[model samples]
Target: MERGTRTPGAFAGALILALLLGGLFPALLASGAGGTPAALAVCVLVLVGARLGWLIGIGERRLMEFSFWTFTYVFLGLAALVQFQTATFSTSTPWFDTAYNDDAMWAVLIGSSAAMLGIRLAARGPTADAPARTPLVDERRIHHLAALGLLLNLYYLIRVGPGTVLLTREELWAAQVARWPGNGLTAFVVAVFTLPLLVVFIGLLGVNRQRTDRGEPPRYALLAVVGCVLLFSVNPISSPRYYSGTVILSMAAALGAYATPWRVRASASAFLAGLTLLFPLADAFRRQGGVETRFAPLQALTSGDFDAVIQISNSVDIIARNGIEWGWQLLGVPLFWVPRDRWSEKPAATGSYIAEQMGYPFTNISSPLIAEFLINGGWPLLIVGMFGFGWWVRRRDDRMVQIGLLGGKPSGMDWILPFYLIILLRGSLLSAALQFSVLWAASWFIRGRRSAGSEGAAVPGRTGAHGGSILTHQTSG
Candidate 1:
């Protein structure tokens, strides 16, 4: 297939790969690898290989990238489900249970359906304009921001480390045995999502790749690197592993938006949106099972109980469940409500232990925005902060749209929205909202200036305006 033609096929391929990489491979690897470190490495390789294969076969880089990220999020969800199922079936070692295989099958199928639907819609047309400048802030600014965020993250880590930190090295390693082979999967996801932007940025600078656009000046890549570093350093109380991926992915999207063309941006946006919608919807279906018993592996890994991991995973599951339920529940109260007792007990009972495994308050409440609001103020702050920031970013996006500096026809911000949403979904809505608002505001300012200039020039004798024509008066002689 040709380059552009490949986006749809790549989306389809990504959906299929997610199934094999997350669902099928996990079990197969478990059977063979015996939960050893080597097994984890092997599984990571398998996933990487699968992703590479999809990229090669499908013929679209953006589609391939989307697939990788979707796989990361979906795999994490699936792993949690697998752990939950193992709890009910048996407390046996290497807790891979068949109890929820049926559920697993359906989850895969449903997720695939949603992804396919999205891809089909996205595939129909070109994306918005691509950004010309990669979103880069000043180097000094980047360093300063990184330093501040790092300090906070370190302070938080110090405060919580003794009691609640989920150190992967210690947790995953055991006496000649290792658990949760999929942890490496998370690591691989982190590396894949984070590294590329740095490479692209560095290459753009006169350091690596030769500059093709000689007329274009080299912009600040350091700002982005620093911001990213700082954000990653912040010891978020949530699943840092998952959020780390989001951070890096967002960074990449920002970079991609700056560098890619408008049409490419549209394609990327359509592809990513389509891919991510799958699990949330499928998960809604999966949760319909009588009981959720997916925390066994986590309990076994952390040497905790089902209550701990369930608590943490429940928060995540609930985010999706709540949104979907609320979306549908707008019709009727009873329609959405599971029996009060059932609602209270099920997630709570299972989730309590899971929460502990999840490191609770840190991952759920102590994340960037969530933590900020709780520690400093409350939910209202969260709402206000988010809206304020979102409005600002939306404004800036207008600027990017006007200059055509941002790639493709879609706004530069559009391509980055998924990345933003991924990071903010479980985060403090306020902080995320604020940061994005700033971004959009910047874009808007540029757009506004350009528009004002253009309009002024359009008026007769508006020579005082920035781009007006000659002000010279004609001589009668």
Candidate 2:
């Protein structure tokens, strides 16, 4: 593989390729009579195609462990495809009629293409000779963090009560839609609980990796398993399927970051297949009435496909109605620590605001990334924002590699950051910010222990320059 800067011609060619591929959306829309379903199908296809092209052309050099590539696959690729397919063929009707317009949809596709191209162009070239640091795992600190996490989990369970997770699917759905305002302290407690979980999760990953490397069974295996079960159980039992799936999937990505490429692929395929098969069944639980036993997973794919396209369309409508919020939507990120009740002027999450404008009962639904940016400041800001985002992701990747966290042996921060990409790319920047803050804090705390040892020692089984190991003895020991 070559390790040099990308030529200007190659960059231009890639940009051209993206534009041509993006044109497929408008062409498909025109051909399909400008129907909502057709527009959605085109969007999904373009998104998938753009992502695949990215992975093939640029991802290999960067190592596709937990980059924006994975984020695209989960949200833009899989989520969009399933929703489009389900809406097109399933017996269930869409949640609402979309105000589908060819012009708006085309703009979205164009913006998306520009975003993808911006990301590609901003990416740094290969750096095989870059200096690498060996990060030492502190088992003692990890154990302490895990214990703290357990306490937090227990506190949350107790505060919410076990009955919260024991509700029937119908009951759970009602609760979600109700959006009950609990005591003022409820939000505070929830935040406290969430912070520890992030720390504990990262700590467990570090401990597990160290134990495995030492040829010892994972010391925190039981704790990890229990934590996952509790984590998944708490959210999915009462909330949406995506919530629970996100927890499990991110955990899998973290744990499997160091696995063979084949293993990672196999695991991801199995996860997606399972999610597709079970999506309808989960929906049955969330349905307003009684439980739906006639689960048609294939048909369910089309069921409830209203969110993505409708939200994008709604966001466009919102900008026309009220003008661009001009970053007002992002105020929640900085003021996240302030409770909405106390801070009466706090802004809503972009997704929630869009949903509210659309008159939907559920404001917790998605607002696509492109739409969010467009609603902020139109195409110019969208392009700039996406390029900055891509640059940041690239920098994070480089940091991982420099810290000896890539190439089948990732440190805790490597696992934490990539797993959070799922949320970052999925939209609702405010929520992503809050979640990321906790994870970033955890990563900082658990990065590596400082020791009075030489940093030049080589890692076992891995060689660095001049026949020396890249990992220091302190890190290995």
Candidate 3:
């Protein structure tokens, strides 16, 4: 079998290796052999090995897996180790060596176990035995998405003032917040970030399809323009890191840079390094009136970027005092379509609520999925919720990998949502809710799911987009 061809991989063994290596990575980072038993650090490193290794070593190289593990390894793992030793955190009030660290570590362990259970169970299902479905792309629709994307981006550019789009990350973020309730930024997301992304992927799929299904060339000209515009819109300097990451990584996946096991592992390793080293420097462009106090990459991990660990600890503390919100806090994300004016009694986001309780001057802290699950209904929900997420990821991963291998084509959701998840995972859900709402709606609108017929791919030999097997094209799964 081709190494790129689908393989069940050594899932069971991989998980064991992930635990030992993942736990070991952070302990090494903490202090060679070290003190405090480093319980939390162990849990985090174990998480990195399980979550990160699950994707690179055993995963099918799906975009969703990359997005999921990237959070575990980069944003969560490095920061945890950094804090364990330095005993510093992002909060104004100190949150180090508190009573909650051990308990929170247990919570982390429980939640991850539940998630892994879901992934394992899903992999055993009957559907995992079925052949993957193929979807025919509507060339006409690709044209529509491209036009729509350009129109929306152009309108957003005008509304925000053309020059405003060129500001630094922090400055641009400040400008968007200033636009308030009536801001045109959502338009930017729907168009610049997602729509053109579809244009490029759909265009590539069309190129590969000509050999298998034997079709005409797609509008490569339009794809060229859209691709260039997407680059301009998502430049690192002006856009938010998460949003920029979504677009750029999705584009790369569409090109097949992340399809094979070796490629996925290589990219995953590089990604981990980048998050540890380069992610801190990202703030160089993010701070207003920059150059305040620069620290090395390791020290910077204790800053706001790594606060998901702190936020989880904070969530655990909140549950002890106020108890979970029952289910009220969970309602806001699904019902995000309802305007704030429409739902007067809507609950604040879990992050904001926790920050309020903690008396932080800023409410823009992260609340990871585990934190959300705990806040919603405590341990039961955390277990059940992660299990559900795992099940869903496995189901989707199997399907998307199949699509990559057999069809060489994918839907808008196939590559997009996974990257968006990076932000959602590092989230104040209410803050992220509207953006996802618009993003999902746009994806649904041009959903590349085949309208009819079973022929979804062309021959797999061409070196079309990012120089990978055309069969796995976008999925590189």
Candidate 4:
């Protein structure tokens, strides 16, 4: 039954790949971008082939594994196609176009494709030095954490009012400027609202534990609380598509959406379709007072919606004029907690920095993972960085697969990292630094909370966050 269920999707995957490479590829070749047909072909094949490979079931098809391929294919691949076909670049700057334009396109294509190769390397790579995940749930500390979040979020809502949060993006920004108490804390405000996310999986842990062990009737009350608070605090009107998608997909994984291979392929397809067709439409209420754009996916791609490729192109342009930063710009990511007042010459977030360099009036554009690697040290860093990243991602995926084989459920960081990778992969590392730090910190806090409870009496979630065991994902309410 399971094998047959995958057949139709496999056929669908082949059909989609054919439509792209057979039909669209010919049209793109005839366009002005045909001037550099080789580069164009590599860009198209590398990008589209990634989606096809994953959909057809390559390697361990874990959720983060699916996400790595899907995000690359949609966010970078589609934009590369449009830019190559039209012979247009989104930078809108003559600043560094002095170099032939194919170079920028090439950098974007090469970096992304290289990362794909790196991901594949995981299969042949050595055993992980340490267990890939340490799943621990200190329900007590988590409740305290969630309580803290509720307090912070309620204070924000009361101060800014719920009306402000649900309003248009422009209005939300205005309210932040006018009402947010301090500088550099808006991300905190947003993070606070999504606090229920931390508890959802823990709730799922308890329920699933009971079901597997005792065969009791399932309870929906815990999940119900999670849903209510999440919706109240987050919505398309205010939260960016990525943030909302993260919360939604994480919740789904917690609900056991990736329990089977076919479901993995199915959801990956849904993600591809949604990102291509519905993502732009979802942005209609973003900055505008209300829905403004119709469901015009192609037009949205050509206009400005998918900026990952172009932003990577801009980073390339920066490299052309100024050379790679040689690991300087990236210094700020790990040290993101350090204030500019103290560091003085601390580099700005790459996206904003690149924007300022390009003289774009707006500084909030994307600077993708490819771009991030390119600007840091050009080809050397791009290859080493992406290969290492791909290897790491594979280790995590393998760990998840191991857990599934053992009939264990992940109820901690392992459950969330796949969703979190979405944010990390959509880079400008500084932009994601705070949230990343928060996750790491929370994992540590939970580990300590659990360890302190058992004292010298026991190890918490052994073999882990930074060692003793993967056999038990200790969860107690």
lDDT winner, 1 or 2: 2
> 400-439, model 1: which lDDT tens digit per residue?
4433321222333444454555444333333244345444
Model 2: worst 10 consecutive residues (lDDT sum): 56-65
| Pairs of residues at least 3 apart in sequence or in different chains that clash in candidate 4 | 462-468, 462-469, 463-467, 463-468, 463-469, 464-467
Supply candidate 1's per-residue lDDT for 245. 44
Residue 300 CA error for candidate 4 (Å)?
Answer: 1.2
After aligning candidate 1 to the native by TM-score, how far in Å is the CA of 307 from where it should be? 11
Q: What shift in Å separates residue 394 of candidate 3 from its native position after superposition?
A: 1.2
Per-candidate TM-score against the hidden true structure = 0.37, 0.72, 0.83, 0.81
Q: Which one is best on lDDT?
A: 3
Best candidate, TM-score: 3
Superposing every Cα of model 2 onto the true structure, what RMSD results?
Answer: 7.3
lDDT at 309 for candidate 1? 22
Off by over 4 Å in 1: 1-27, 30-53, 56-59, 63-85, 88-108, 125-418, 424-477
RMSD of each: 16.0, 7.3, 6.5, 6.3
- In candidate 4, how many Å is residue 286 off? 1.0
Q: Report backbone clashes per prediction.
A: 65, 5, 6, 6
The list of candidate 4 runs beyond 4 A from truth reads 1-34, 37-60, 87-100, 129-136, 181-183, 193-196, 199-220, 447-477
